[model samples]
Target: MQTQRNRRGYIQHFINCKHLWLNELKKLAHDLKNPYLLKENVPEYPRPEFHVSHLKHDTERGALCWIRTDGGFKDPHRGFRDPHKWSLVWWSLAVGPEEIKAAETRLLEKTYPNQTKEQAVKQQSFLWRFATSPAFSEKSRYGSYRFTFPLQDVLSAYSQQFCFGAPPIMRVFRTCLFKKKVQYSVLVHSPANRELFSEFPLLPGNDPNAVCAYRDGRFIWRSEAMCETHRY
Candidate 1:
């Protein structure tokens, strides 16, 4: 009876071991078949060639850098083609207010045209959306203006101007209340969703109108007349 009991115990132990081994083998086979299951095979670093660049200032969350890809800013009618390469790199720099002001002046002078009467109206209307919106008022004491650009166009422009090395494009959007206090904002987009521009809060009771300002690209606001009222 003792010998029979020992044999039965050994058989049960052997069966359990075999079952365990088979289960492990099945798992190994499944993993091998699905290579994506191995994290090591995945890319650890972000690939910049196909991403957008989003950088912000260290001191002011409002200050931003929107570096366009090579050949991104040219007119499409001028035989512009999408590079299909998108990459985004972000960095922060600590700078003084004067430096920020100087940079803003330079960028505006270089990129934005003189504000026309129509343009002024458009901006005011845009600003009014934030001022009038109850939702905006509840969020915070300040407001921001956000700009969105087509990534392909920006990159194309960057490539043509700077062949080997180029300084990143940094644009500042400033909104003020009572012409005394200013709120800052930055423009940003992700590599995964480069097709659409993100939304930011505008002034309250502003009409939804799209206006292309010669000085500041295209701005979509509530209406031309409302924008004019808010002009300084």
Candidate 2:
């Protein structure tokens, strides 16, 4: 059995990163090498239970908010049925209200090439239904970002070059979040390389303001930070 202090420490660490704690627990289990002992001394914490409650509330509120704004069915199961749906919703939220309107306009023009302005507006509004639908906000069983490249050439170029020797490319969707007073990204990865990509420094250590590269597969998404010339 873990000591009380040890249990508290483990719980605190686990709160920071559940996967890391679980990994450490697995390692400990293997080192002990005794199933009977492992069963008797398993670490217990209330965080996972609390986390579920927090997640459920967030999911419900997010879903309801989307439904009220979009005039769509309020199906909570849709988020559960499709994992990408939640991320997409999160992504949509990340893009400020103005961007969403502009994106809708752009999509309408592209999707309805020959339609008149009035017809296209009607069609586009209908098309926007998918974007604001509960069907697209489903929480995924496997939590990660999903990327769908619209252009085949963009997909092909990245696949051949960047995906080699790297992890499986699951999904890639873009969103803006505030980090250090500027909008930073929170990306999900399939073959998640959290350590490798976490602090991807774009330039040498000397430059405080440098554009960073967030990489997955063959593509590198650049941050908005301006790159500084190297001062040798």
Runs of candidate 1 exceeding 4 Å displacement: 1-155, 158-179, 184-186, 193-217, 220-232
Residue 31's C-alpha lDDT in candidate 1?
30
Residues 104-186, candidate 2: write the lDDT tens digits: 56545665677797786465333223233221243332233332222334335434554653533332222211111112232
All-Cα superposition RMSD per candidate: 25.9, 22.3
Error of 2 at 60 (Å): 17
My TM-score estimates for the predictions, one after another, are 0.16, 0.21
Q: Residue 89 of candidate 1: its Cα lDDT?
A: 30
lDDT string for model 1 (1-232, tens) is 0011121122111111011222232354343343322224322221110012221212122232221333222232232221222233322212223332333344344455785656544542222231332212222222242333453444455545553334223222222111121112233332333233323322222232211111132221211121112323
For residue 79, model 2's alpha carbon misses the true position, in angstroms, by 32
Evaluate all candidate structures by whole-model CA lDDT and list the values in order: 0.26, 0.31
For model 2, how big is the CA root-mean-square deviation? 22.3
Query: Which one wins on lDDT?
Result: 2
* Whole-model alpha-carbon lDDT for candidate 1: 0.26
